[model samples]
Target: MKVKSATPVDIFSLTDQGDALAVRLQMLMPGASRHHRPKPFIEIAQSSFRSGHRCIFICSTGIVIRALAPVLRDKYRDPAVIVIDQSGNYVIPLLSGHEGGAVAFAHDIAQAISAQCVVTSAMDYSRPIYTIGMGCERGCPLAFLQPLFEQVCREMDAAVTDSAVTDSAVTYSGLASIDLKADEAGLLELSKSLNLELHLFSAIELRQVEHLLSEKSEIVFKEVGCYGVAEAAALCCATKLTGMPAELALPKQKNARATIAVARSYAP
Candidate 1:
């Protein structure tokens, strides 16, 4: 979907533990600027917020929130703020649960650190989101891809709700495809239309999740070296993103030009 890459992070660390955690996070989040002993903690944080960079504080949540509280604006405009304890045992999304993606970002950091992610967003548990995996021809037109995507979601929603009145639209957090199709224009447009990111996974990574799919196809395996692109991609990306196993909310389905599937993460 060509969404902007992650904002540069300004990580503030005050102790040996914090410094160690910062190094670990750098591997997962590139372009992160770690401040072992930046001027004053408050000054560093305020400057980061002013510059529109994500601020990661390796300290107590209360300390971070209190220090940044003066400059805090609405969540939509504020940069994401995350707090991790010095011991690195807990990761918390202190602000920007959705718009700034503090929740998901915290999960990513926790996964890398083997810590628990503390998310306060209720919808994260209640309204659960899924990823849509798709594989299509090289130059499939939007006309074919868009409608096919909608059709798959509708079918999934109906299955989940199990009601004739299932006319409500289903929401997906992101789109996924094989690494080869990472730059596919149709998938890019579909992600833009849905306002979500496109997650690309390699065939080997997709294969790792094949055992989780509802069914497998030898034809797909021969073609992609993965049992099923749609289901496998969906499951693999979800597991990677959440650091938890994911299940197919909807199994693979296809049209003349596109194959699709849906996978949902377990509630944290």
Candidate 2:
């Protein structure tokens, strides 16, 4: 008898068993070209989050997810994450979609692979809120968010505190919109109502994007790592409303990729 080599598998199946194969095919397909075909996973995830891909499947072993996780917008980061076992079984819920379908995904994979489903934190925690506010606009990290927690405190002080508020005050704006790590009902709704955003703390500053959202020649939104999300938000909000960035007029950042981040969040 001949012995065969072992194939690398997701074990947990964060990438859908089929999803990973699909992603790989897209790359190998002959018709798919750079200008015509969609961008690769990293760029696609970022762009998808920016362009409003609520759920994304990452094929490669969670490296992309880990890398981008730190630099994505909080409110905007609700793409359901699943890890798929290469053998088409053992799907695992790595993050997102608490009450939504992610649990179903895990169960489906478990049933198929005859593997165990492990759900911690999200499933057990009755109330775990993640507030993904906007990025700080100055040239430094989005450290301004920590102090803004006082805003939430003030709301609590005013007795307007909500039962939904469950700590985890994370912000992300300099990063991509897809880094949203909370359930859609939690972070997405809060951002819409609170008029807030979330982002990460990045080495690439935000001096230029400030000039766009300016007031009378003086830059108003002047905080560090603030421009990327602002611009992306402008683009996304526009896309949702009409599917075009022309009306939003969000100025393009020089380093479009560097605009993403991961930070504590708050709303004002």
TM-score, every prediction: 0.50, 0.29
Model 2 lDDT per residue over 74-160, tens place: 422343345554554344566543422244334433443455655653333222122222322323222343334344344332321
Which segments of model 2 are wrong by more than 4 Å? 1-39, 52-61, 75-77, 99-101, 108-116, 122-268
lDDT at residue 233 of model 1 (Cα atoms):
85
Name the candidate that leads on TM-score: 1
lDDT score, candidate 1: 0.74
lDDT of 2 at 30: 24
Query: lDDT of each prediction vs. the true structure?
Result: 0.74, 0.34
lDDT of 1 by residue, 1-268 (tens): 0111135678888889889988777655557888886778788789898776778899877778788889998765677788999888998888876555677667657765678988887756323457888888888777778888888877776544532212456667778999989778888998898888889998898987665565778987788788888888887777667665565667778888988888766445
Off by over 4 Å in 1: 1-127, 163-169
**Worst lDDT 10-window in candidate 1:** 158-167
lDDT for position 198 in model 2: 31
Candidate 1, residue 64: how far the Cα is off, in Å? 51
